[model samples]
Target: MHLDQLNQQYGLPELSFGDRQRGFPVIKIKNRFATAEISLYGGQVLSFQPSNTQADLLFLSDRSHYRPGKAIRGGIPICWPWFGADPDGLGRANHGFARDRLWTVRHTETLANGATRVILSLQDDEETHKIWDYAFELAIAVTVGETLDLELTSHNRDQRPMTITQALHTYFTIGDIQRVKVLGLAGLDYIDKADQEKLKQQIGEVTIQGEVDRIYQNTAPKLFIDDLSLERKIEVCNRNSTTTIVWNPGMEKTATMGDLSPDAYQRFLCVETANAAAETITLAPGERYTLGITYRLL
Candidate 1:
């Protein structure tokens, strides 16, 4: 939509348009309770902070490129069709086209409870068809307030069944990565990506010391991230998510990642709500599925 149309449709003093470095468009959201920033390119939420809080609940990398077609390094990035690598090994982009393509702002609403919600959408196109060959429509509805909620819905338009894996790759700011503790997933089995894909059982809370990337299967709907230094707990609850992914690049790996600042590894933690690996989703024609995630500060 054009800038004038956006301003007209939204018709709110709290919602405005702004551009970042390189002139990429962004939507700024602010109300009486919380504030957020959404980039139209990926329907990505870059920052979310409660009105009375001192820190942003979400994190964004200072060095992340704001150029179009590039995934902004942090916040909540939508990983769809596939996750991580090309499942069929045809050398497609790492996390598919959803994050790289621009999404249309469908509409905006103010809930009765005072939360601001924005909905964005994307559908199959020539570019996406070249890579995945699937007919589908994706919509992401984000609600911001004392809590941040994202509901990603997918509809299968093809006649046959479709199998897919996905994730809401969320980066949460923390006082210190080393002093963080993630709970829930304690007895679940996870495939350790960094440990050569070996399946292991979790005995207790998770604490990171080195490069860690694991997809925990059959995870509970609710989990918690306890930041010792910040003295805050962020509760993550999900629906239609069978897998939870926990990843941190660590010191050595962060040094080689150009998209991230050199010391970026220490400022945030990724706790993803996912449907991945052996927990893939099979959708019949005309069927729809939604991955719902709610982040509440406790």
Candidate 2:
């Protein structure tokens, strides 16, 4: 079906749920120009279909059948306070608590510049504090135009200082993993997951094969994912994030993900902009920080 047609037909469902459990509201933003879907949960982009009829599903919801009732999946999982693997010896689960919680859709408006903005927010609640200590407010504003723009803001409400790491884990669709090439992060220091301590290493252009997971620290201005089969290039630009992660759980790991088909890895690649390792932020009381990423299809 045509992308615009799908938007006009499905837009956003008033109610979206998972197995009787109440899910977040879906916000639909569309005009003659562009079409996009945002979920109140985690303030994630459920789907983005440009004028060209290209659809980019940012998360993989079909990867598992047994929901841990905790760990979140599908569509831009928000990793906050701790990016990956708990550093503070906190066993608060993988990624963090932001994804599983419900977010509020604050406002939606069409800008004069011909772009539409949808803002969503989430504040710390009694349930969240049980897992992590601290009260904070998170705002995620997604602007859709010729390109898809995501802006994340964190406000510290506690009096004490807090250090945190976070990321916008984005899973981009592609034609084939073997036919794709990621440009940028060439010759930069990265943590190789294959080695213990993730031994620091320097690398160049990214090539996919087997189980590849590396965190590239102190990255560059932009990265490009060239999909030869799709005949397209996805340009990623980041703001306020120093580390970028490139990961693809190959055939073996793909099999482990219950919701994913054994060959799912061949059609998706994750190039996430993150704040990990040295990029961790220290937010004082009343302080606010912002991080952004703009994806343009060329």
Candidate 3:
């Protein structure tokens, strides 16, 4: 939609539009409770900071690509249809095409409690068929308030049943990786992607020391990030998500990524809410599934 039409239909006093570094359209939300920025190119929430906090709850890379076709380095990237490497060896993008396409702003509203709600959607088209030949509709509703809440819904628009793996790949800001501890995943089986996909059991609260990439299976509904450097406990709660992925590309791997700084791994953490591996979902014709997440400081 054009700028004028978007402003006419969905604009509010606290919401406006601006261009990113490379001309990607971004929706800015500055309400009474918090401030946020959403990029139209990926339908990604790039920044969200509550009014009472001194730091942003999310993280965005300084060297992230702000152009089309390439996924940004941080914040929340919607990995749909599939997650991680090409599951079928199709040589497709690692985390699916949803994050590389433009999304339409479907709706916006200001809640009674002064929170701002914006809904962005992507639907199947001829171009999407070229990548994954399934008719589908995906929508993400973002509520910016004292807390940041996200609800991603997928609707099967085809005749046949569809099975898929997906994730809300959220990158959160931290004072220091070494001083952070993740709680509520103490005793679950995890697939260690960094250790040759070995299956292991968690022994205690997770801590970041070096390269850590594991997908915890059959996860609980909530987790917490205790940041000693920041002196805050951040809550991560989700619904309809059975897996949680914790990843930190250590100094060695971070050097190979063009979009991240050499020492970027020390300042961020990825605790993804997902349906992956043994937790894949199958949707019958016309069925819909929603994965919800909420983040707040406690």
Specify the highest-TM-score model's number: 3
Residue-level lDDT of model 1, residues 1-298, one tens digit each, is: 6777777877466777777654567788898889999988888889999888899998899888777678889999999888899999888888877988888888888888888889989999998889888899999999987789999999999888888899999999999999999999898899999999999998899998889899999999999999998889999999999899999999999999889988889989999999999888899999999999999988
The ten-residue window of minimal lDDT in model 2 covers: 13-22
At residue 59, give the lDDT of candidate 3: 91
- Report the poorest 10 consecutive residues by lDDT, candidate 1: 17-26
Q: Quote the lDDT for 186 in model 2.
A: 77
Q: Which stretches of candidate 3 lie over 4 Å from their true place?
A: none
Over the stretch 195-257, how does candidate 2's per-residue lDDT look in tens digits?
Answer: 554656566678898888888888886889988878888999999988998888899988888
Our tally of clashes for model 3 stands at 0
Stretches of model 1 off by over 4 angstroms after superposition: none
* Minimal lDDT window, size 10, model 3: 17-26
| Local distance difference test, candidate 1 | 0.89
The number of the candidate with the highest lDDT is 3
Identify the superior model by lDDT, candidate 2 or candidate 3.
Answer: 3
